[model samples]
Target: MIRKINRIFQDYMREKRLKIGKNIWDRKNKEKIIEDNNFIEDNNIKSILFLRYDGKIGDMVINTIMFREIKKSYPEIKIGVVTRGGAKDIISNNKNVDKIYEYNKKTSEVKKLAREIALEKYDLLIDFSEMLRVNQMMFINMCKAKINIGINKKDWNLFEVSLKSIDYHYHISNLYLEILKFLGIKNIVRKYDLFPTNYMIEKLNLKNKKYVVFNPYAASKHRSFNLENMIKISEIILEKNFDKLILIGTKNHLSELERIKKRFGDKIIIPETENILEVVELISKANLVVTPDTSIVHIAATFERKMLCIYRREIGKEDKNSILWGPNYDQARVIYVDEKVKNGEEIDINKIKIEKLKEKIDEI
Candidate 1:
């Protein structure tokens, strides 16, 4: 299949890039390297840059905790982040982030950013990219920081102080916490930081109305709900005696959402949102959130809102996503549509039946 071929090709390229990095960095930097995080304080590090070029909103949400905890521990340190794919909006108004660099994946743009960061002469650079991407590795090599720290999933010469391999038994957010623990941060609290505006509240006139947020779209088809299935689930929730059903999606989903809106009439309110922050404001005030596997799961978790999530897994394979990135709050409920999936195959969330959803809604 094309997906399998792409994976093989990507692995081959990653290995090739790693080899080139070893050759380039091994010869370029011959100075003594420290293996611990003491270099942060010993060198009197003032400015710290974090590389989060993966750019998924959920990953950015998870890293928000690191920005807050790091600032709490080192109040005088200046924090900077390099993010791509418009994920900069997640941390746009964050008080802990002093600077944010946007990478557009263009060679000229990246080189320009490198020059700009080099001029700042940052003291520390931290990379939480769990895997080696050629672009991220190249960017890390270009930044002129006094010290570099990165996750050591595989052997690489780029980092002076490499953190240990990620432990899959725990939540993925803990990896960011591990980075903080390495820097001697204590009493760390595992949570997400997202601030929303009052514009959405005022415009929707939802001062104190009870509502449930239904997000049926994700970045991938395998995780998104089809129109028919979404309708069935929506009807079930509407029968639960709630004030309203607020449907959410991107512009690409507008046509489908409009069809559902027409079917439900005034019962469904699909508010036009300017950005992801408006969506955050909407979710923060929701009585409950129902979503497929997506970043919304983490957003609802950030507010510790009552949520029900639909997830999928291979029949016989280990469910890595549920273990690592599942709901972080204790009050959340998740339903997996694995019974219909073939062994070792990706789960199609649309296959989840209406009866199963109704059961969960009633229980909640």
Candidate 2:
């Protein structure tokens, strides 16, 4: 199949890249992070900028969570974020972010954006993207900020404050929190927040119902569950008196959504929109969420909704919090599946043990 071939090719490229030592991270620079975090906190920063270039969903969630905690600690501080163009909508209404700066990912615009960033006069800068050393270096050198902080793989002298070098194997959230800790903000809570306006909730018209939501797609091929397995899960859930099933994802996932529709017909609801707030509002009304490791999972967690989080076994092992981090009031259960197959390699959906998932859902 085309999917199999694509996966094989991707695996081959990854292996080849690894063979050339392209994936290795520097180990020596891990100690500097602690020193940098300390320096930033001691200075009492008033304005801060968070820079993350690889603006994927998970990365955006991590940044949003960190920004929220930072705002809680330093209520007077103004926090802004700089990310690639498409991510502005994701954090547009986030209370923690006072502003957002969009930068083109291409090299040609880097210098121009760098200049714009330098003009901000931030008191502190936090760089979340690991490979953007050149970008961080430009910001540190050009920006008027007194303190520059971020994770570094190498001893990049560009940052005024940098964390101790770390292995790439760590969970992204913990790494992000470690950056915050390095800045003297201890007791950082690991909760994610997504605020959907009343108007947005009204638009979705999601009333009280024992509905289950499904997010069957992931941006990464390695992380997405099998579409067939997802369909089967939908069928099984519908059979269990959870008749209302909502499928959530971006426009790119329409085809996958259609596939589920063919399987479930009118039983599944596909809410299509570019707005994340709309999606958050939709998930807020659901009784339970079944999703791959994606932003919607975190959003559901914010709403204190019970979640059935599906994750690649490797990622699940790396961060226990991947399955557990949710709103304080709700319980979340994580289901770990191997990375080799899309969705547990055609496991029997009827036989799939979801007692834990059901228990969590019933708890609330």
Candidate 3:
């Protein structure tokens, strides 16, 4: 498809430009990132800009804890976020964020955005992404801010305060907490908040009902459980007298879930598509959630809903992605299986037996 071709071209161009920027163009400035790694305090800071390139739901949701803690510590300071275009939904109607800047992921527009953000004169700048994309790094350096903070585990650094020297050994949420501590904000947010307005509450009729929610898809195939297996699990739960199985997903997943509905009949409540708030609204009403290693898991955790997370060990090691991103609160269980297929690994998820899934389901 044309979309796939464009993504390939974008990645190629970004890699090419990063090579050029690293070896030749911005070599001196990159060196300067290492020379100044000490902490810099800004007592009169009033405005802050946050840079996050990966705008996936899970990425944004995890960072919501960071956003909340920052605003809680400094109620008067204005916060601006620069994220990939479609990801504005994560913080779209959020009251804590003052501005949302959209970057279309083209290397061509880096400088233009840099000039625009520089004029705002942010007192603090933070890069929350794990991999420092070169064009984004270049933009981070160009943006004028008093105290610049970037996180990386190694020699790569493009900000005045680099955490590369310190090995981060906590969960993703805790990692950000440590960064906030370094910035002189010691009070960390212990809770995650995703507010749903009355409009969102009235959007769905499933409120105050007993339903089991199923998130059968993920951003990548390896991270999702097999749909066939998902159906089997749904059958098991329905037999236990749960009200109904609700399947929530984005537009790309509509047809596949439609097929599931065709086979399962009215016992399944398959919504064609649900936006982030709608998903949150539905999950907040569900009795329990069965999902893959996706944002739904994290969001369910925020509500403290019981979660049965199914994931592939190959996608991440036990410590890195499994334990780190597993349910932050209580009442959650996880099952991992070795993957067999690289793309859309329906068989990989089959490695988890039906009885094992039922046991976890029954526990909830």
Candidate 4:
């Protein structure tokens, strides 16, 4: 198809640009930053730059906790975040981030942006993604920071310092926090904070209510519940005596949501905006939240709210099964369908029974 050909052409161009950009930078080995008693003390680290350019909303949301922990570890240290414009909200309001440089993807002038960030002369730069793609490593070299750090990998060879996880059995957030712990950040707290503006609070208007939230979308079709199954789950949850139940997702689901609203009465509400903060605000006020494996589940944990989570079987080693992302909090419960599947077989959301979901909801 023309669309697939166009996609391949675009990818080729991006790779070409990345290769050109890598050559433009001074790609040579430098001194590696290691964990020492006087690592921070000797280097006189005053400010740090964290590079994570993944535009996915969920990745951005989870990194907020990492940013907060870095600030808490050193009250006086300044923090800088470099991310895409689409993902800026995750770190925009955090008091810990003294500077945030967002990449405008429509007109990407990364070299120009790098020149400006380099002028800041950050004491340390860390790329958390550890991805070796052209865009991932290009800016780290261009920044001209004193000590560059990233996760250790064969292709992540540009940074002066690289940190890797000693233990692989931890959630993504904890895996990221290990970078700080290696740098000797003492008493790091694993907490997430998003200070909502007064307008945001008044917008959703679920303030101090005994309502619950239902998010039926995930990153992929296989991960999210289908409309028919979602409706069934809603019917089961409605059997409970909760105050109000809100149904929300990205604008892609608007048509389906309208159908659900028509099928069910006014009890199921829809959000006016697609901005993720509204979801967080709703989650913050809700007595309980139910969602498939997505950013909503992570946000629920960030707020320490009671939640029931559902996830599909991760087909391969890197698919991130429930054991990896399952909530560590006592208030959280997860149902992993087809937990024992070994090969990369995609499981349908409809395979989960209504009675099974109701049993989980009844416990809540």
Best of the candidates, lDDT: 1
Question: How high is the lDDT of residue 137 in model 4?
Answer: 58
Backbone clash total for model 2 is 13
Task: For residue 147, give model 3's deviation from the true position in Å.
Answer: 2.6
Cα RMSD, each candidate: 2.4, 6.3, 4.8, 3.6
**C-alpha lDDT (0 to 100) for residue 234 of candidate 2:** 73
What's the residue-level lDDT of 198 in candidate 4?
A: 44
- Kindly state the number of residue pairs that clash in model 1: 0
Which consecutive 10 residues in model 4 have the weakest lDDT in total?
314-323
| Residue-by-residue lDDT tens digits, candidate 1, 1-364 | 9988998899899799877765764322623644455555766779899988778888888889988998988889999999976478878888989999998687678778988898998888888867765556667778868778877733566666778867777789888877877776789999899877768877887767888999999878888999999899889888887888999998878889999989988879898887888999999999889998888999999999989998887777788888788887886899988854554456788888778788888888
The digit string of per-residue lDDT tens for model 3 on 102-179 reads: 876676687888889889988778877566566766787678676676666245444556674333344566776677
TM-score for all models, in order of appearance: 0.92, 0.74, 0.83, 0.86
Q: Whole-model lDDT for model 4 versus the true structure?
A: 0.73
Q: Rate the local accuracy (lDDT) of all candidates.
A: 0.82, 0.64, 0.71, 0.73
**Regions more than 4 Å wrong, model 4:** 1-26, 29-34, 105-108, 154-157, 165-167, 199-205, 314-320, 339-345
Off by over 4 Å in 3: 1-19, 23-43, 153-157, 164-169, 197-201, 314-319, 339-347
Q: State the lDDT at 105 in candidate 3.
A: 68
Which scores greater on TM-score, model 2 or model 3? Answer: 3
Q: Candidate 2: where are CA atoms >4 Å away? A: 1-41, 133-136, 165-172, 186-188, 314-330, 339-364
Tell me the spans in candidate 1 whose CA falls farther than 4 Å from its real position.
1-14, 25-39, 339-345
